[model samples]
Every structure is written in structure tokens, then in C-alpha cells.
Target chain A: MKKNLKWAAIFGSVLLVCLGVIIFGQFSHGTTSAEIYVDGKLYKVIDDLERQKFQSLRVETEHGYNIICYELGKIWVSESDCANQTCKKYGKASLVGETIICAPHKLVIKIVGTDYDKADVTT
Target chain B: MRNNTTVQKIALIGVLTALSLGIYAVEAQIPVSNIGGIKLGLANVVTLCAMMFAGRLAACCVLGIRIVLAAAFYGTFVSFMFSLVGGVLACAVMCLLIGLFDRKQLWVVSVFGAIAHNTGQLIVAAVISGTGSVLSLAPYLAISAILTGILTGLTAQRLWFSPLKRFRITQTRDGK
Candidate 1:
């Protein structure tokens, strides 16, 4: 029993540490960029949408279409043809590691930054 | 062991299934402002309790039926697929770890089950979204799983030895 508790404690601490790193990474500032992917392919990359101030792109895919709205430092799916409006409800995310996914539409909007390697940070 | 008949086992599984479905509905109404696809998974408590008091097969029966009924009541086909994936993966991990862990370490098993559930859901999300970016949320999902798993695990651990023995669905090994 004591050994079980010890194991639980060890696993719990490891999860906590990983969570802390993710949170810290989320808060830290880095070069502002965003990536949009559809059906596992890169659809668009906004290197300086922050400078563009405001823009909207209507993306059409085999699943459906989504109107991706970009602001100073955030991106979102303003409109979607999916049954559930979860993607639209996600609204906007400006953080370095934030994301909005339209599952029904197979659309992904992710906030990327130059400071971190996207593939390395996540499993 | 005399009370652990087939009829009693079926009734117990049915009751637990209903309870889990009810929990799922109530949890859906609770607004949780967190990352996408994260849930408290309160219904899993019933699954865990069923697994401990009854057996893995009984637990699987309850979980499978509960998820199906719950999805039919308030979820779409896509949502149902996600639930099926998460629920099956979680139960599989929990049942597999039962023999691995000695003592009353149900919590550890529960935590691993939660992690498995989240991983399954994450994979679904990644596939649906068509990007590996959804994997970025893994850490947050892991954290949520740990917290919620501890809650459900402790509840099951307590209920395992509670007065609900009268409804004993499985024969006790040590004749409690």
C-alpha cells in the first residue's frame, strides 16, 4: 500500500511538472505567428497578421468552409458550416500555443511563435 | 456468494449504467471554461466502482451501455464516436492495470485510465482537425485527467468497501 502511494506520488509530480511547463510556455511572449491547416496540410501561415490588424479568409475544404478571422495577435474561425458551432464558439486565441479546431470541417487554427519549436514542445 | 446470481448481476449492471448516464447528462450541463475537449469525466466513477465491486466484464457492460444511451439521448454521431473511443480506451487501461497494482491502489489505476481516455480523445481531435497541433494540448489534458481521476478514483475506492455489499454483484474473494 505504501509502495502504491509512492508510485502515485511520483506520477502525480511528473504530471504537475509537465503542466507547469505548458502553462509557463503559454504565458511567455514570442514572435507572433499563426498557422492554419486543413486535412493535415498547411493551408496558410500568417507571419505578420498582427501588422495586418484585421483580415478574414474564407477557406473551402472537402468537409466544408470556415471563415478564419485574424486580428492583431489572434486567429479564429468566425464562421463555419459544421452542425455544432464549437469552432466558432472558440472565438479567438492570441497566445503562442493557443488553438481552435473545427472538427467537423477538419480545420485547425493554431497560434505559433518563433521562440519555440512547435513539434518539439508537444509529444 | 449466494446473492451473486445472474439476475442480481444484470440488475446491478443496469442500475450502474443508469447512474453513469445520469452523471454524464448532469456533467454536460456544468459549464467548464477550459481548453477544448477537456471534461471532468464524472461518469467514469461509476465505471470504476462497478469494476471494483463487480468485475471487469460488468464494468465494461455498464460503461458501454451507458455511453450508448447517453449519446443517443443528447449527442451527435461524431460526439458519439469520440465518447466511444475515450470510454473504451479508459476502461481497457483500468482493467489491464488491475493485476499490475497490488493493495488498494485504485487511484493509480484511475489516473492511468483518465490519461488513456484523454489520449484517445486527443487522437480523434487531431484526426478531425487534420493537424497535429491538437497534440499541443496534451499537457493540459494530462493535468485535467490527473485532477479528475483522483476525484473519481477516491470515490470508487471508498464505495468499494461501503454498505452497498447487499447488492453484491460479484462473489468476494475473501468472503467479506
Candidate 2:
């Protein structure tokens, strides 16, 4: 019985450590630009967000809509027409991999740029 | 050992569904975590126990009814989609693991099932949101799956030895 538990504990611990490393790596990689993807396709990129004082980008899709608000260092869903409001509840995030998702509309706001360019700088 | 008469199978599935739905109602009232998809998932105890006592088919019947009924009662279409994916994947994982684990290692099956459930939900969230970055939530979800899985697994294990014996619905080791 003790041996059985030992196996489960070992497997569980290994999984936990692997996941932890991924999360830590994401937070440590900083980016000021945020990209909005509508249904997995890139819609827009807000580059060098620090230069912008405040902005609200409205993304209206066939499924629903979400208003993504961005400022100096962070991005968030300020308002949404989705069912659960999960994106709004997610509040705000500024890290490189951070994302605000409105599932009902399939909208995603992800932090994905660097200090090199205006986060909105998309060619 | 349980009889496999038509009426008996129907009654077994019905009973399992009722018990799980009741458990679901109570669990719904309690919010264990602030995160949207994170919860103790106590109702899953009944589903797991059904798999052990009844059979995989019966357990699936119970789970399917519970998901549909719960959604009809209060859940939105989006929540319904999430539950369907999570519940089905979780059940499938348990069905596969049940054959491999020692009878006493039922907790292992439960833990794996819980993680599969969380993974299923995470995948749907990522797809619906349109980015893989939502995977940033993976580590947190995995950690929760382990803790809650252990608790629910241990609980199911205790019942397997205790009350489930009296309510046993099938003699067949259906998965094996």
C-alpha cells in the first residue's frame, strides 16, 4: 500500500514541476506589445504599449463582442457581451504569455511583443 | 453481485443519475476557487463509484443525463459545452486506467481522471479563446487537478470498501 502511494506521489510531483517551470518561464519573459486574435487569426497588434496613454479596442464578431482595454503596461477586457463574462473576470495581465479570453466570441488578447517596436507596430 | 435484468439495469442507471445530480446540486452551491473552471467536482464521486459498482455503460448513462439536466437547469450553452468535453474525457480516461491499476489503486485512476477532466476544459478554453497562450493557465489547473483528484479519489476509495458494497450493481468486472 505504501509503495502504491509512493508511485502516485512521484508521478504527481514530476508533473507539477514541469508545469511550474513553464509558468515561471512565461512570467519572466516580459513584453509590452499585445496582439488580438479573433478565431485564431491575428486581428491587430498594439505595439510599444507604454507610449499609449489609454485605449479601448472594440472587436465585434459574428459570435459576440469584447472591448479590450490597454494602458501603459497591462491589457484587460473592460466589457464584453459574452455569456459568462469570464474574460472580464480575468481582470488584467501584463506578462508576456498573459491572455484575456472571451470564449463565447472566440476572442483572445495576448501579450506577445518586445521593447524593440511599438506593440501596435504591425506591418 | 447484481442481476442484469432489463429493469434492474434501468433502475441502476436511474439511481446513479439521481445521486450524482443531487451531489452536483450541492457542489454547485459551493465555490471552492475563484477561477472559473476550478472546483472540487464532488459530483464526480458518484460517477466514479458508478463505474466501479455498475459498469462503464451505466456510468456513461448517468454522466450524460447529469450534464444535460444540469445545463437545462441553470448552465449556459458555453458552460454546457465545457462540461460535456471535460466529463466525457475524464470518464474515458478512467475507463482505460481501471483495467491497468491494482484494485486497491483505485485512487490512481481517480487522479488521472481528474487531470484529464481539467485538460479537456483547458483545451476547450484555448480553442474558444483562439490562442495557445491561454495555456498559461495550465500549471495552475494541473496543480488543482492533483489536489482535488486526491481528495475525491480517496473519498471514492473509502466508499468502494464501505457503502458501495451494499449498493453493488454488477458482478462483472466490466472494464477488465
Which structure among the candidates has the greatest DockQ?
1
Interface RMSD of predicted model 2: 3.4
Tell the DockQ for candidate 2. Answer: 0.34
Q: Taking the tens digit of each residue's C-alpha lDDT, what string does model 1 give over B18-129?
A: 8999899998876554465467788998998788767899999999998889878987777787889999999999999977875378888898999999999889888777
Sequence-dependent TM-score of model 1: 0.83
* TM-score on alpha carbons, each prediction: 0.83, 0.77
Please state the CAPRI-style docking class of candidate 1: acceptable
Interface RMSD of each: 2.6, 3.4
* Model 1: DockQ vs. true structure: 0.42
Best by TM-score: 1
C-alpha lDDT values of all predictions: 0.79, 0.78
CAPRI grade, predicted model 2: acceptable
CA RMSD, predictions in order = 4.6, 4.4
